[model samples]
Target: MNDFSMLPPAGQNFWFIPMEEVALFRRFLKGKRVVVTNGCFDLFHVGHLTLLNEAKKLGDFLWVGINGDQSVRELKGDNRPFFPAWERAAIVGSLKGIDAVTIFTEKRATRFLSLVKPAVYVKGADYTSQSLDQEEKEVLNSCQALIKFIPLYPDRSTSSTVERIRKGSLMAEQNK
Candidate 1:
């Protein structure tokens, strides 16, 4: 078993934990309310920050389950996840509200969610309880985890950021 307790403090090496070691890590969070959220978090924008910060407020510790590179590609196509899983995990881990980060290689977070069994599971306002995958719903139900949705930032997103970058590159090329 991995000794996550021997690991560095939350900001140091706490993010980017291996999935197999997560159960061990859970031992340290016994008395704390663990909140979990999952996403690709490709470009890391204000909206993502907002969601994470709000998620933290609902519990004592926040665990972010980031989609692995392959999973992101499967869900968002080959060109998605402009930043790889490790890079994305590092970035999210550096943020203030995040406590730990784990990369999961699945289109849905059912497995990770089951393992973490967080007290609260958060999603973007774009997803309603009814819209969630049946498997995800079942996992949450089985674990008795509360499902919450944080409001999304209206004008900020990785997709929009990518579009802006593309347009800027095109404009620059035109001017040259």
Candidate 2:
């Protein structure tokens, strides 16, 4: 049997592994199919969960790469990522489907994807093969990782959630 003693206890197996330590986790995943997905996951919603579950179905191990706080700010603007990277990572790591979570500092998952070299790379349906980041696309191609797209939950997104919060706040202020 594989040595799972180093891993978190059952039901809390999802670990926030540092990039440098990813290789150690890989060793434990030997003989298992690995699936990787990346996103900001700022507000943790059903859409994100759905995608994650779908990705997990494609492989035995599910590794999620989360955008670090600075990366989120660069890609999503200053007001975005209301939740800090550590909190977001913790929330995602707590989910059932994820086996491991890594917070990456890059705006895209190119380097992370290269390092993990997962058997499959999953993305939301919103992104098409042509729309993928050039660097990410190149890395995935070089690694020969299969690209899979899972359908997103309609009308459920962090952006929409933020907008709702803003509108609610504005209305509350107006009433006061």
Candidate 3:
């Protein structure tokens, strides 16, 4: 039960944590509500920050699930994930509203729901309570987590960010 060596280094964030560590994570959530949200997070952007801030408001702690590199490749294709998995994870882990991060390799976050059993399941408003995709529907049906659809911010998304980055039109790239 004691594994100081495996603990994240001082100030170093952990993102791709294992499912076996859920118990330890739950210990941190004891008596406190937990919120969960899942995404590829291929590129960190304003949309992501908005969603995370909203998710944090729904619970005392927020846990974000990032799709693994292979999962992103399968979902987005070969030239996707503009950044590698570790880098993406580190970026997500460092976000202010995100208390913890983990990787989910499955196409759906169903298996993850069974493991985390968070009190709140946060999602983008693009999906409706009735129109949830099959896997998401399953989680809503069996999991104790309540589904919350946060409003999506218009004109701010990873796709748009990636395009901006590619055209050399983004001012942030100039500073980089």
Candidate 4:
């Protein structure tokens, strides 16, 4: 396990933990409900924390499936993902309440669902039972996973953060 304290003070809690090592956390989920969620998590923010914490509450273990760096680049484009997958994974893994972290390369976490077989699969409030993409819908419907949608904090997003950075830079240039 990476020593989280070795990271910079600003984001010391975020430490890259390889998903292959998740077996160590298995004891936490033994005979207990497990909840799974996946995302790019390029920018760590309050909304992300809120969602993660909430997911943890629904089950005994919270397993976060983060997109690998290559996967993030493929799904989100090269300009996307301000932070590398390792950094993002580390950050999520370091959270106090999260039980395990893993990397899944697919555009969606269907393979992860098969491996973990979580009792619940969580997404933001934007989706519904019927709104799930065909594969996701099939997975949920076929007893592959249970779907749960948490409320979305509409104003909090990575895109907005990127926009804010751009605006800040532009304003600085104007001031000069």
Candidate 5:
């Protein structure tokens, strides 16, 4: 078993814990209300920051889970997750609103949600309780974790940003 408590807090490695260590890390959480959120976080954009900050307001600690590289590819296609899992975790974990970060292998967060059993689970307003995945919902129900939706910032998304960058690059090349 990993003695996460012994790990140095000053290192970026401390925050980038494996999902398996959630139970061990619970020892440090004691009485804190933890809010859980998961995403690819490939681009580290404002929308991601807004969601994380809002989620932190709901609980004492915000634990963000970044999907593994393979999982992101499975859900988002081969070109997705412009960054690797560790890189994505490092970027997301650096945010002030985020307390802990974990890398999970599943496409859905069911297992991670079950292990963390956070006080709250958050998603973008793009998802509703009715629209939530049945398996994920079941895990949340069993764990009694409240599900909240943070309204998405207008016209903000990794895909959209990528498209805009691509268009701008094309225009720049045309001018040359």
Candidate 6:
């Protein structure tokens, strides 16, 4: 729908959108059923895939929001966001089910959610409807969006992966 070129195709059908184009994208999606989920997505994994795939099933299109690099560092610490925001968005966008991707600087997805106003909003089962950010909840309520939670995959996480790599390196050094 956009006349200008967006970030190159991350996947067969997905679009890596520039922030300036979010309004245009949202307008383009006006009548369609949209699903949304946001996160760091700093490291890709099956857990992410499952969530995105499941989210897509709930609606006609899936729009993913990735935490900006500074936002991730603030929430996940200074050494966080192993991948830059653009790359993370591109990688997440490249996945099989994601239709669109955007990067937001806020630590919470409230602003992004408000802007997109998806028909369904999905999150990992790790969070409860009660435990969600109060402001975010208010925004969702105001927009009348359905909230769905995908069950968390027990063994899949960026933190766990990082630790595993560190432990493997230590063992290799010991063997040497």
The reply for model 3, stretches above 4 Å from the true place, is 1-10, 13-16, 165-176
TM-score: which is higher, 3 or 6?
Answer: 6
Cα shift from native, residue 43, model 2 (Å): 1.0
Q: Best by lDDT, which number?
A: 1
Best by TM-score: 6
Q: Kindly report which residue pairs in candidate 3 clash with one another.
A: none
The lDDT-based order of candidates, best leading, equals 1, 2, 5, 6, 3, 4
Clashes of 6: 0
lDDT agreement with native, every candidate: 0.87, 0.86, 0.76, 0.75, 0.85, 0.85
Where in model 4 is the C-alpha error above 4 Å?
A: 1-30
Better of 1 and 6 by TM-score: 6
Q: How far is candidate 3 from the true structure (C-alpha RMSD, Å)?
A: 5.1
How many clashes (backbone N, Cα, C below 3 Å) per candidate?
0, 0, 0, 3, 0, 0
Per-residue C-alpha lDDT of model 1 across residues 72-132, encoded as one tens digit per residue: 9998998987877877787788787788999998899988988888999999998999999
lDDT of 6 by residue, 1-176 (tens): 22223554433367767667787789988789999999999778888888888898999889999888889999889999898887787778777788898888888988888888888999999889998889988988898999999998889988888889899999999999
Task: Give a tens-digit lDDT track for model 4, residues 58-138.
Answer: 888788889877778887788877776666777898799887777776777666665666788888886677766677566
Of candidates 3 and 1, the better by lDDT? 1
Candidate 2 wrongly placed segments (more than 4 Å) = 1-11
TM-score of each: 0.89, 0.89, 0.80, 0.80, 0.89, 0.90
User: RMSD in angstroms, all models?
Assistant: 3.9, 4.9, 5.1, 3.9, 3.8, 3.4
Q: Write one digit per residue (lDDT tens) for candidate 2, span 1-176.
A: 21234445653657777888887777788888899999999988899989998999999999999998889999999887787777777778888888899988888888788888898999999999999998999989897889999998999888898889899999999999
Q: Write the per-residue lDDT of candidate 5 for residues 36-124, one digit (tens) a residue.
A: 99989988889998999999999998899889888999989999878888777777876777888998889988888888888899999
Model 5, runs deviating above 4 Å: 1-14
